[model samples]
Target chain A: MIAENYSLTGKQILHFETFGFLVRRNVFSAEEVAKINGEFDRRRASILAEIDPEEKRTFTQWPTRNPENPFTASLLDDPRIYVPSEQLVGEDSIPIQSHCNSYGKSSGWHVDTFDRRLCVIKNILYLQPTTADRGALRVIPGSHRSPLSEDLRNMDLYGFHDDTSPFLNASGMRGEDIPCYIFESEPGDVITFNELTWHAAFGGYKDRRSLSYNFFTNPKADDEIESMKKIVEHTPANTQGLGTVGLEYHPNWLENADNNPRRARWINWLEKWGFTDVLNN
Target chain B: MSMLTEQQITFFNTFGFIILRKVFSDEELAIMDDEFETSLKTIQGERPDNEVPKHFNWSNLGPETPFLSLLPEDPRICETAEQLFGEHVIAVSSNSNRRVGNTHWHTDQSHPHSYGLKFAAYLQPLNSDNGAFRVIPGSHKQPFNDKLKHIEMHSSEITVPYYSCDSAPGDIVIFNFATWHSSFGGSTNRRMCTIDFYKNPETPEEVEGTYDQVIVDEKVYAKLRAYGSGFHPHWLANPQNSPRRQRWIDWLRKYGFVKSEEA
Candidate 1:
């Protein structure tokens, strides 16, 4: 059994650093997963109700720091989340965002961000079992590093206009046929990857449920801080324009920060870096 | 003629492997299969009980099997190797195998500086459950290559992710030597042939890497000798008189792997 305050072992850290990702099986108990699933369903139902019937069915909600869902918000404080983030990034690393998504389409192969300066890690939890033929996450190992990363960027993997992607042109295979490691997962498995790693999903059913908890290793350099700013400024606008105009965190999240040392420390860092102002409110 | 497109080159560089479907026609596959079977029979006949060993292997380069011997120099194979490793690439060796059971995850070239490739053609239809070749893409590149060392030890567990190169008789699968690859769930006597090639050394480090590979190949050749097989005289003498083949022969001779008597 994993301890309550579990930290990543040296081997696990090496694996993540080397392969650009790591998987921890059964990190959460069935009871904990059920709680998370319950929160996701409740929030998803509310978000779906607001959308037009003919609009795309995908729904995403920023649930991490939402005061209305204290159980979901408290996940940032959970050791299973924080400890690995701290170990991989640093102790000063702060929770950046948490998203609950019910995906309606398959994701094309791409990295979360192209900004190599940003040291962000995303920990993903799928609410159901998935395989390669299902909706399992696939990654090209070590694509985040130099040379390979630059090579992929030059290929413009994301810029293909028609059916002819560079992957297809070169390998005589379709996008889904590109060689990659598929993260076949069970409900309690936590798969963590660097933001720069190339990943995709295919053949997923509509309303595929997943939760992503993202963390940013505290920016120490000027360029990294600038990258962070761009991320903070653009995230809300990119997420189908949801949430308050200028606020990254909910007001209740900021209000509760006073009572939580971990959240307070992160809030203070965000304020110092002037990132909290990006959302205006 | 250059056989690979720019996009295919980029894909191979990025993923460490690529598949070319129908590289050989059905008739060509049939002829090659016949040649391979005849060679296997020749080796089996020399054995004490006329029995082919599990995972039986023999050199593909011999005058007795004219078609199999010329595969390394075939334009489809040689030109593609040139496109990947430049015009100076040399055919290292070609061997046919009758494999059984499963082969575990490992790289052919593990040295950090060494670079090489293999062209694999399976003689039967295969898929994920039945001996399809599998690879961890991008694992040929460093940090990833070294990171996968643990796989060699815990191969059965195989925590790392991989792609299966499902193939048919006429398909060709090419992969970097540094890429971690393996096969599983194969029936007994799974027939396949492979031709190895190495990037011609242009630097001192690459030269050293070439020497390192020679050491590895020496061990393999010693095993082949025990199995009553070795490089054919026609192959050693380079009867085709190809300059690229000559360069490789010279290098092998310099390392004492090929001697005057053998030629």
Candidate 2:
């Protein structure tokens, strides 16, 4: 089953390490995409009302907790991508923040592996067709291998400053303007990129949404199978009804018994994914 | 010398933060300035194809106008980073932009991360009017939502005419990768240079290139997955994003200096 549908191709792996991105076509069905989008709107309405835009900077980023109801089921049911995940991360990979992103939407960019020496991958499943007219995703091709500064890669991490003047342009995007490109698909266009690859939000209107999930593997885990087994236990049983939850789990859980090679790589990925508080938590 | 000494390392350990004063030299500043001049022009609106306009330009006037470079041709900057971070250090991200003309403000951790630090240096002496570096000490422990719900309901559009903020040029400011800060674009010309770094707390800062060797925990993976992709917040350029105190005042909380109940 693992070899049949999910395995990283040499070309894809190269793309991931060099540019920081890769693509998978038709990873989701149209109906599923529409279903998730509908639920997103329903929850977003209430979430948006809670915030007074003029006076707040941080919202509870991801929804606190939820179950696998119709909305969540739709959110998590991306058949095409999960199978592909086995190839990129490992044979037994599962969505890390499946419930939380539904509430937050829009993952910002940061260098994968935290630096060039580290290796990591980012996965994007267009549970829905994200078009430029509807906010297609944008990314800097080959950014992972660029001769640029780390700050340059993370420029958008703090936030995208819409301070571009009609007369003057905002600076700092080094590659092509379209480095950030739309993930073209019907519903399940699962694209994977280098974790360090520079990408951004593609511009579009409502329903231009997508589902993103990242996974990691210890390149040399003594017991990769055992560690993955523990992950399932940590997850809430019947994860059928949880909203997107950020800081899903903390680090340190895999220390000592796991050693650094594989275990250390897992922790490194955490820092790049924007879970800055992981260690502290 | 309120610099990032051994005690600062302990503070970073307990609270997850550290501060380093003007650790950069004048020559580094000049190189950063020259790079900013070139880099800014590279990502301008002229590049219609590029979608992520997450960086800015302006060496003549602005704080940290030039993005930080880990692979900068200038060996001094890299060597300094190596000295501080140890051989295992990696360039997480860098930026070059003009801060508030008089008072721009915001922290390093706009985006959440697993474990990292924001280390920066002022390339030019900043005019206090333009923007000086100041931090909220140990605010990293607080869980500020990515939504910025606690900040005032100001959009990312406010600028010069409506408000004022400033800073000093040569004075270096290095806060935690998670610390919150802001700067005002001074009316007078100002130039600032800085770079942010990320290292595994468990790994020695001096370890050479430790990025891919370690796998980011699934917790980190899941967080990014849930927060959406690196593109949702779209926080690139804008003066409205002044740092913390203004956020406190705008939020109208009981104490701007003290942590709140929600925090």
Candidate 3:
């Protein structure tokens, strides 16, 4: 059952507004983490067996439409994630992307997006303990705001200039040496961050396991609706073969909605956007 | 009389760009060709990091060398800029580029205004079949601009009808900073140079807007040792009598776009 008073405190809200991210320590219980890890591990093993290990691939939107694991499916209504998401964005926010990642190499610093209009926040859960050397998330606080965001946005972070130079470094410093808050975590700790906030992982394990749920503010204006449509069009088919059929979400998650009014609001919006036909199909 | 005609001005306003045929004389064109070669060697010689990409570029190429220094104040350039941007215009930055392969469609800056523009001249002939400059006209405007930009970012195959700016050596291409542009087919050694200019701010808000853009432009230089001052030392040190250039330099220095020590 959802917690009775599942809400973020005023101080936590202020912290998120100031830094563009928050860490909710031990949001998932040990038992919950174990169950989530077990489900993902079985899926990862099956995925790995089907692919060449030498190719070193990663899977996104894992176990989303899957119905075999009831515990993972229940995350949709989890008070810990759902409550904080509602507090941060709004009741109208809906999950747009999900992933269970095994990265091939350390990722360079980048914002989830360049546009300022779209508001997509990602909630990441680490299934294993993580450190900087083991590829914990690192962020530059308040980087999502203007001036700082503007500066970072123009740089050749991915080396279009062949500079290979670390971005946002006033003086020459290695990308790892730039000042940042490392999200060192034990299993079950949840980190939620604005998609626009600059983040990177350095020196991570090849099999480093993490799950992410991306949620976005519901489109209200004409421009926001267009932006949302573009995001949906660009999104590839998920593991459940949901979006591939159309912009329709995972059919299984829709079927499980039943009497949940909160999920119904999102479903209504999706149907308006031509995402409902796949459910019947 | 203005260097550019009224129809040319209207075309520029509508499409966010215009190509001025033979803007430079044969002598000036030859000097530019020699200076570009010199600049390539100069940048390579001054490179502090070998890891930096071999396709080199350095800003404010104007004051660094003589023939290039005369470009900003040249009547052909200054008069046309004044016509569009108003009486108080500022030369922001100038640079040389040695390009490689294809550049996907994108705006240099996405700010929804005509505050800044770039005038580029390629050293060699180019066509759409050979890596010619391409642009989607009227893409600097709102709502639709954003939508087209979104497609440019998301999709690889660009199906929109785009104007290919096939050019010879003397042709000058001027475009708004927000205009969506790219080059499709090109060799690795395609050489080009551009001079950036911005409208002089009439209000504090406009001044701040200019400040924000300067910060964005300076991020490119933040990684290099030679670019320690953001602007080249020559850009700071070279004395100019024109109140227009001086006023702009003072504003940049005051706002920290120019290094304090260099100022």
Best by lDDT: 1
For candidate 2, lDDT tens digit of each residue in A75-187? 33333455455566665343445332431234343343434432345566554556644445666443444332232433333233233311113333322222233454566
Where does model 1 sit among the CAPRI classes?
Answer: medium
- Give me the runs in candidate 3 sitting further than 4 Å from their true place: A51-55, A58-63, A158-173, A237-249, A275-281, B1-263
Q: Which residue pairs does candidate 3 place in steric collision?
A: A61-A98, A162-B53, B131-B185
Question: Which regions of candidate 2 are displaced past 4 Å?
Answer: A1-14, A45-65, A68-79, A92-95, A99-113, A116-119, A146-159, A162-185, A202-208, A219-281, B1-263
DockQ value for model 3: 0.01
Estimated TM-score for each candidate: 0.88, 0.35, 0.48
TM-score of chain B of 2: 0.46
By lDDT, is 1 or 2 better? 1
* Interface CA RMSD of each prediction in angstroms: 3.1, 20.2, 18.9
Instruction: For model 1, give the interface RMSD.
Output: 3.1
TM-score, B chain alone, candidates in order: 0.92, 0.46, 0.87
Displacement of residue B32 (Cα, Å) in model 1 is 3.0
Every model's DockQ: 0.53, 0.01, 0.01
| Residue A213 displacement (Å), model 3 | 1.3
User: How well is each residue in B1-263 modelled by candidate 2, as lDDT tens digits?
Assistant: 22234433443433233334444456755666677656455545446664322223322212333334222212443444444555444443344444335433454443344334554455554433445554333334433222122333232321111111122333444445554445544434334444444443353432222322123322332332211221111222213553322332232222121124313
